[model samples]
Target chain A: MVSLYFLLFYINILLIGCVLVYIYKLRKLIGFQLGMTISMVAGGFFAFTSGIIFIYVYPFHFLPVTIAATLLGMAVGSIFGSFFDYQTLLSGYSNGLMMGMMSPMVGAVAKNSFLFLSFAECLFFASLLLVLSSARQT
Target chain B: MILYLYTMLGINILIPAVLFLTMKKKRKLFTDRYGMTISFSASLIFSLSLGTALFFTLPVSFSVLIFISAAAGSIIGLSYGILITFQSLIIGLFNGTIGSLMGTMLAAVIIDPSLCGLPSQFSTLLDRNIILITLFLTLLSLLSSLLLRFSYRV
Candidate 1:
């Protein structure tokens, strides 16, 4: 019975993954779609660093990834969040709820609080793109 | 006997399945090199600590060794959660706490079912449980990677 439950869960996750990929591809083919892929990626990295700090050093107590997710959207945030959540769960740490609470705190200390840092990163990239495009135009 | 095996298999499947589903929607989010490196390093550390805890079993040395193992495991678990999962502190903490709790719980429930009495037979049961959980988690991890790839296209 447990095995059956797990098998069903695994299948569901796989199906979801495939569906999301299909949608992503379709969006790409259509044209440029405003999204938060870069931020999400950056956030994941930030979470990783924070995790290390928490282990080896003082608990940095911030969550840049959660902030990114909030800024970007829940789908992206949850995806990244789930990864972190699952890893912690597997390792026998705290619950997901506790981790969520820590997210903003971690973000605050990481020298890149969500509100200001994400905007800055986004703007910087946008400007860089703009400059390159203008240069091409010339 | 078969029931126990099935239960263990279920745990293995559920964890990975949840991980895969949760990760699939935003696979692109994990593309950052920093997150991948940190997560991998953390996982390695965690695995090592757990290994040490499992292999060593001297009465005087056990407590100290287990404490160190717990600390190391927490660190690695947290790091993996934060970096690889894209800054999800919730995940980091959860990973650390859950990893420790599960290890202790397994020892208590499966290994030492009788608090007052110590028996060698308990060790065998504990070992079996550990193997089952580990196998399940590995499968889950593999599936998670595949899901990540699939989600990346979107």
Candidate 2:
């Protein structure tokens, strides 16, 4: 059977990616091509870091760290929202950091399998963003 | 024990996250203080753990792992937002290589793992002064990397 945690994690990632893409679409800051690329590349980093941060701050002292991580995520998100129009790497890193702050990390394995899974999340987000943006443009 | 394992898990996940973030080509962040701080912390954490692991495993595979970690760390450090100087890359690379060797020694004593290499060879390598010096250098390298920002962009 598929791991329940894995399912939740992917679904969470997909929902966040789509919502953010929609917001970006409304902002009218980034072009379709750049948005797709950023979502794909930035999404992977964002997911993996989210998983790592989740692993670090879960179960114990979750409240304090979660709050702090939330602030950090907002900082990251704000940075990205401001700079997406200009196309900057710092903005992407901050966005990745934000996404990392928001994701849940299931304490299942310590292997690198999660790395590939995170990339898959990125690709999934990228394609979905591409489709959504393309639809809106047309 | 659990902390180390958590950190191991954390680093494995964090490395790729940082790597993908660095793939973007921007001309501003790395040169800035905030960006450098993140890279410095990530490099130090990544190299130290891998280095520590190398000491215990002494497996040929660990060496390859060290190389990959170092490469990824440098790649991320050098390219994060703004292209950082070559000196920063060198500092990061140095941290990874030295950290691994030193970590090997520290782990041999702390975890005292029986694997990695011949007991006799390890014993000789783990001489008293070696431990002190390794500890000193590791700290020094970490501090210096964070403080110094050489401006040679690759």
Candidate 3:
């Protein structure tokens, strides 16, 4: 069961990586405002999912989980934000940081509910899809 | 350990205060968009970090922590927004409040992980974890302030 959850976590990460690459390729077409929105959604969504999945996996190591999630959020936000402008970067970074810090706690609260986890994963996928579609339109 | 936490909190407060003062010195030079960004990010980061620190440093008093943090966040936002326009002020106020609320919630969970149904740790481990998080948040606050300062160049 734990392995299954771990696999799901990695798959989500892989999907995020793919999205990042796609966004990078389309960086030229997106406007500054859209870029900030894209980066914020990506960073916050990924951080929230990863944080939840991680906490659900290892219910013990709270400290490390929080640290990892926060860093992950910061890294994703900055990378995505860097594609646009300094203000975009700042917006993404702060949003990601805030979400990252809050996520593991939310995961912890959800406890052993696989249903909630699945819903979170689905939301992430749906949001990513929206981001890609919007980017393509741009 | 309590003393150490208080010291960290003071440092956390000071970093942003310095940043706010430095930014204040040049409010006349800021462009409109830049002013908004500064107001938004500064207040958000300030409220979040301070809220977390207060929750961790004080005793387990959720009501007090929440009230203080929310007020602190709104004030920070208002201060930054006051430098700009009505729109920026509103943005600052909302973001600051949300950010502080989040920080308080996170701190609550950290202090008592059992709130999430996970088995809680021993006191020593919990203290150590609190210290580590505090240090990490301080570093984050510093990095963000540095980023804000460098925005002038970019």
Candidate 4:
């Protein structure tokens, strides 16, 4: 049943959330609540976006939607990167992997170079946002 | 066709995973209430603009009625995206850009599957299946968020 899939999906999400919370608590012990918050907010944002995309965007094969999502992530990541003590290099790496995974999807659906480029732009912008945020913080 | 589905599915998984990983490393970064709020708001606005753009671009027609409907649908989608994004932001929650993008794309795929110039048979099937899958994934994300909220309650 479709509801079953939905149930599984939610269960996985809950588990992930719990883990993140646990990690946040651990990080809190070290006075890194800021980092934890950033990560939580980012995760929340991702989950929200994923839901929206599933409900609306992919059916039509819109390129801008992906671009916008990537841009938002970059913005969030950049903010986190700027103020936190840790380097966002890892964030960048993760984003890159995501971007790589996404390219083929966009290509398959939209087949537009502009869409692909937008995804790339999002990653670059996210990296920039992180760096800028870090600079501003320091 | 399968490639497209797999890629979309992969993105669905990866976006959340990456966000979770990022948060696991730095939850405090989100505590800046102002910044998170702003980012969330911006994402909502971005989603609206994208939805609007999609509504207008697809369903290309030489006919007046079709054009009018397309324009109207674009407006509706844009408004809906904004509404949903804003609601989600208020709760100190967020989804990644990819998810938003996917939402818009899913809309387009449904409204204008032929726009991509795919073979009609494959695109149609893909479009329908994607809609189902996206729904499943969205539900999953919401459930996960709820779980996170409950589990993290101190």
For each candidate, what is the lDDT? 0.38, 0.43, 0.87, 0.39
Model 4 lDDT per residue over A1-138, tens place: 345434544554464455444433444333344453444344334433343333232434334444444444544444443344333312322232233224324444544334543454354346334533443453
lDDT of 1 at A5: 31
- For candidate 1, write residues B73-111 as lDDT tens digits: 565455455544555444445455455444443334333
Name the top lDDT candidate: 3
Runs with alpha carbons beyond 4 Å of true place in candidate 4: A1-137, B1-105, B117-119, B123-131, B151-154
Better model by TM-score: candidate 1 vs candidate 2: 1
Q: What tens-digit string does per-residue lDDT give for candidate 1 at A1-138? A: 335434533443453354345434443332111223322332333333333223222222122333332222323334433333333222211122223323333333443234543443354345334423432342
- lDDT of candidate model 1 versus the reference: 0.38
Q: Distance (Å) between predicted and true CA of B72, model 2?
A: 7.3
| TM-score of decoy 2 | 0.28
Candidate 4, which CAPRI tier?
incorrect
RMSD of 4: 14.6
* Docking quality level of the chain pair in candidate 1: incorrect
Docking class of 3: high
Which residue pairs overlap in candidate 3's backbone?
Answer: none
Per-model C-alpha RMSD: 16.7, 15.7, 1.5, 14.6
Please provide TM-scores computed only on chain A for all of the candidate models, following their numbering: 0.24, 0.34, 0.96, 0.35
How many clashing residue pairs appear in each of the predictions shown?
36, 6, 0, 57
Stronger candidate by DockQ (2 vs 3): 3
Fraction of the true interface contacts (Cα pairs closer than 8 Å across chains) found in each model: 0.00, 0.00, 0.88, 0.03
Candidate 4 residue lDDT tens string, B53-105: 33334445435533443343333233322333444343322323433454455
